[model samples]
Target: MERDLSCSWRARREAGGHAKGGKVTSSDVIMVPQIIPTDSVSVGRAATLALRCTMCHGARGMSEAYTPNLAGQNAEVVYKQLRDLQLGHRKSAIMGLHARNLSDQDMRGLAAYYSYLLRETPPSSLLGQRKAPRIIQVGSPMFNIAPCASCHGGSARKTASSTLEGEPENYIRAQLSAFKDGTRHNDINGQMRSVARQMTPEKVETLAKYYSQR
Candidate 1:
């Protein structure tokens, strides 16, 4: 089955990277099959390349700052994000500079290597997901919003959705705010934007605190 790229990235590229007011995450490259190459060369290249990434993402792929952790992150998700940055579909000052010079193989290799690392365990202080707010566990269907867990809770997640468990509260809040304000429209099919738009700022704060510190 083929995916459509006419919406944003493809159109932008075809229009010489100047398609105005219709940007989206550049997931067009993964429309077909999505697989990370684990071959020795690819892995070695990725490992070597990761030397530059470790400054922010930690030597093991977990960041000490508010940045997203790359350890055990979904390979496809990481790959798409990098591609988006390279294609100007996503905006990040630091990442854009780094991804600007990365080749296709470099991106794939980096993504595969990061996913190969072990994930950091959540701290004991973190609260149980069961005790989360009603909107986080079971969304308000009256507003047509699905549970945050449906896509970001780390189980049976939708394609291309990022994992939110054990993430930084500040980071989660910022991204949620971005989505709510349409600043982060990279989410596939506007799923995140739609969900965030319906949530109140207070609800966003609550959700962030629950997912991060509980």
Candidate 2:
């Protein structure tokens, strides 16, 4: 299984060209619930605002590229990420540039608009508990690793956790690698980074593939 996983991970990396290298960012952004847009948010305004993002994030928030699908994601999560990008807490050249111009209201509107979209990308079970890979569903007790699903999946989903199911495999893998390598420290109090460090590269690839298939 390890051999197969290594081969597949290399193949995907070579073919995808999904992610580049990273640098460690010291995030001082606090973890607080965002004042997300309500149901009354103006979709037209949000659509107009998202026009600048279409080239990379797709016409409707779901990306055919290696980026994540924003449809059906938590509004709070979306707003927080935008805020982080704007504040220089997260490291993304393209995202930082686009986010720099957005006001608080603009971020909320975009968050609400994307969250309101019907989740049809991979048709994963967004409304209920779904089967997950063992590594995500249950962590390695001996390694003191926490399960990914505890905070980012199913009924126990945390307040600011981003949805992972149906994201691109390489995107997931790349982010996990960033966490493991100390190149992404935007996670609250290093929770994700700590868990990721305990996971082997093969395990990371397995987890990424499992979610991508959902």
lDDT of each: 0.73, 0.72
**Residue-level lDDT tens digits of model 1 in 150-178:** 88776668666676765678888888888
Whole-structure CA lDDT of model 1: 0.73
Question: Which candidate has the top score in TM-score?
Answer: 1
Instruction: Give TM per candidate.
Output: 0.80, 0.79
> How well does model 2 score by local distance difference test?
0.72
* Tens digits of per-residue lDDT for model 2, 1-214: 0011010001111123333354222322244332454545365688788888888777777775478888888777787788778866677998999999998778878887888876654443653455666778787888888788888887899877889877888889989888889777667767787888888888988888787777
Query: Model 1 TM-score?
Result: 0.80
In angstroms, what RMSD does candidate 1 have relative to the true structure?
A: 5.3
Give the Å shift of residue 124 in candidate 2.
Answer: 7.5
Q: Could you tell me the lDDT of residue 88 within candidate 2? A: 64
